[model samples]
Target: MISTQKSFEKKEQGSLYLVPTPIGNLDDMTFRAIQILKEVDYIASEDTRNTQKLLNHFDISTSQLSYHEHNTNERTPQLIEKMLNGQSVAQVSDAGMPSISDPGVELVKAAIESGITVVPLPGPNAALTALIASGLTPQPFYFYGFLPRKKKDLVASLVDLNKREETLVFYESPHRIKQVVEQMVIVFGAERQIVLAREVTKRFEEFVRGTAPDVLEWLENEQIRGEFVLIVEGNSDIEEEAPQSWESLSLKDHVEELMENQDLPSKKAIKEVAQLRGLQKREVYAAYHEINE
Candidate 1:
């Protein structure tokens, strides 16, 4: 059994409480989070206005300080100093847990370096919330905060992650979700399963789950709205191999496919196909010889 009184008494001075607020629904706020915010000397919030709304709803009158990304470097030291003076401060984001896709990591590091105790009060998180309802494998998963914006960068990122066996989770805005989905189809394949969770816990809460291409098509027919959490299934090692296309007929046919389908030069296409299919240059040459003969 845990001893609540002992734990409270042993609480070190200059402690930092990493409190988690609701991602969308107010009811998701844990009781411990509220108590910590109320008892702490000050609250550090990502957005004061948004945090203020939550405070007002809970009737919490605790004073708050801004600790967003832009101000974290300048303000972290000062916040640490306050903790050193025996003040217990709670760090919170506009929504969800501080530092997990929010801006409390720097402060936590500072507090730890200064010998301050840091405690996390878990409550709600959009990533985990979306993952559970995604219908994808939940045990092994990877959280990628957000997708890169540049088309090339985004494609490169997805290509590297294509080998991972864990489900991929990412935060995305409505504006770019469709584009990201389209790129995902190119890198991960159209048949890959995907889940899109939009406006979670809000009135317009929605979950769209299907193959990458299908989901992309669905998004096109609806108005884009709210923040989105995307969960994509990873590569499977046990799936049956796809039937080889005409491109797989021989090294010659492979080169032809690249020319016809991918618009690559014959020489470059032959080299690319050989590398992709793991065939020796001599073997590819023999197949090409047979085609010509």
Candidate 2:
């Protein structure tokens, strides 16, 4: 029979701590995260070299084991075994909070399934930092971790998001930021408000706020650098209508007005008017059909 003494000792020692490291600035590391890293029996890291640098900076001498996307499947079970063997452990990503567009979710899930005590410590996050300073509507925002790299998928995703009335936040690498911004011009319209933040919480922190087309043009003139956090303004209450001259005109005439004024498609024009009038697309279609009928 198993000894009750060993079980009680295991319960006391086995616990999992999730720690957040700074994203760009070293100063963003929290006191609690530092303390946990120092005290934990072992630390799991996305990149041992990167975590070593942070550890050295903070004077944390805790042992580290590599646990990232490449090795997570193989390493996770072993790590859980160690925890089960009565060892307090901590997990950290290269930067920012673990399991947040990072590689700690699976490990956390494993620990939970094993009935290990899991704890999370607060720290720096790039997306939230950029969102607060974006000068856009803050409440009811959507965090879309990263946009698709391919053009077709990216445009489709943006189109889908265009239907939502909440601010959208996304991360984009420096190389893709300009292309993403240009596509945003097509999908969300040239004049939709956008805020581009770079090097957040670092020495080179910068926020550029303007219309999509304007920002796209500005990016073209300058060299894009550093990690980027993009925030797009959602649909506004103020409806941008076709010119008044087209109000009393035919459906075909209205389409022409939109083409001249907004350079939009016939279907898009109809949809815009339908939204403004609080009617269905088919209702607008029927009016157009009757007009031509």
Candidate 3:
């Protein structure tokens, strides 16, 4: 590994700062974030009008240039050029961290490739804010910002992610929450636990925790509004399930499916498993037959 110690030295070029804004309640805004916004030469805002209200509240006079999804291709290079000219810039999304389910990641990636210093200021985030209070295992959580919207892609994503053991977090919209939860019930099974945090940090903020079926039932019953952050409980028995991934099937399940469907014998299935996963025959045999004895 090529390692380089970054001495706390000053760079002659301007730095790109990723400043996090409040998710909902404005009181969650940090002092340092406000100071950085004030100090920066220009602000790259996801929405200039939305950010203007924030700046007005904090008494910051930094000029904003729109940098959103529709205009990112044209605007990213311009922002990079501004920073390259030794002008410090702060990028802020509509809410929460700039790149979490928002724009600015492309700009951040471009800035880093150009060796520009990228500074991230800590502040409010909807996912973590929901996860910590979700009453689920907090450590080793997987933050998947948003899921694929299409039916096939969404199924494929859930199939791949269902086998993970870490707590899973996802940002979802209000309109699709019901259908998403319903799909989750189908893909992840009904017994899997989940924490549904809605309108987080807002006046109508609410968290509903239960199994997949339970939450699905709740969504069916309630009047859904605002955005959502889904904290899903991962597979409880991960070690056994992790060694091999054959379309979300266990090594043994894959072997069994092959045997049942393709009319292969136990030995043939085990050999196929070895060939496919690069596992020793004996190891496959052990996992398949539960040969712990």
Candidate 4:
């Protein structure tokens, strides 16, 4: 199951390039990303109409095939077939990176399973961009893209996320911003630090930094618009405890144990072990997946 990719190496089959688009400011688009989109045989877009505006701006005439949440099941195989036939494809979301609170993960998995080279071209990402400027500890941060919409699920999730000792990052729409902040006040307390970054890299880009209560009060006075990135201070009062016997196990096994016992997904479970062992999340993730990188 160990697979390694020398991303740029020439191969018989074409590669699947995960190209990221600008989050807001069109000027933020990278030259390399643009070039890949132009060179690809086809561009699998989340929304062809929206992507057309971008294509027109950049003058990229690559043919596009609609690929979004609803059409993923059907479009995946067709796109995979193209790549298998030696036609390269660039997968792009409506905005930002593909698979970050958006479509493309399933396609990525399918490409990997099909032995197609998967190349990621990094660019604008709202979560990391917000975290660095949020005045919170950036390293060892947990990026939970978006929380569940259900009131019960959101509260339950926050209660579990509250125990971590690293900064938490979340994405929220304009409508849910106020509700999410109010719930944070109840679960994470009024004193916990919270930073709200919205309209990222746009003309109206802004960041609201204050305690949970402070942010909620501000929301009540203003009209919420644009997407929001919520950066929350982690639990600082976690008491240090003796290392358990489980710490002796391999990193992969440790993550699996946490997943089974705590009912955590691989991403959350990996974050837990990363915080406990003073390691980067990527390092733990690689170990768990047996990836050389």
Which candidate number maximizes TM-score?
A: 4
Model 2 reaches what TM-score against the true structure? 0.77
Each prediction's RMSD to truth: 8.9, 10.0, 7.5, 12.8
Error of 4 at 59 (Å): 0.6
Clashing pairs in 1: none
TM-score of each: 0.78, 0.77, 0.80, 0.81
Better candidate by lDDT, 2 or 3: 3
lDDT digits (tens) for residues 163-184 of candidate 2: 8789999988999999999899
In model 4, the runs with Cα more than 4 Å from the true position are: 239-293
Instruction: Give lDDT: candidate 2, residue 163.
Output: 80
Q: Per-residue lDDT of 9-121 in model 4, one digit per residue for the tens?
A: 89988999999999988998999999999999999999999999999999999999999999989999999999999999999999999999999999999999999999999
Off by over 4 Å in 2: 1-10, 237-293
- What does the lDDT read for residue 231 in candidate 3? 96
Q: Between the candidate structures 1 and 4, which one is better when assessed by TM-score?
A: 4
Candidates arranged by lDDT, highest first: 4, 3, 1, 2
TM-score of 1: 0.78
Candidate 3: worst-modelled 10 consecutive residues by lDDT: 1-10
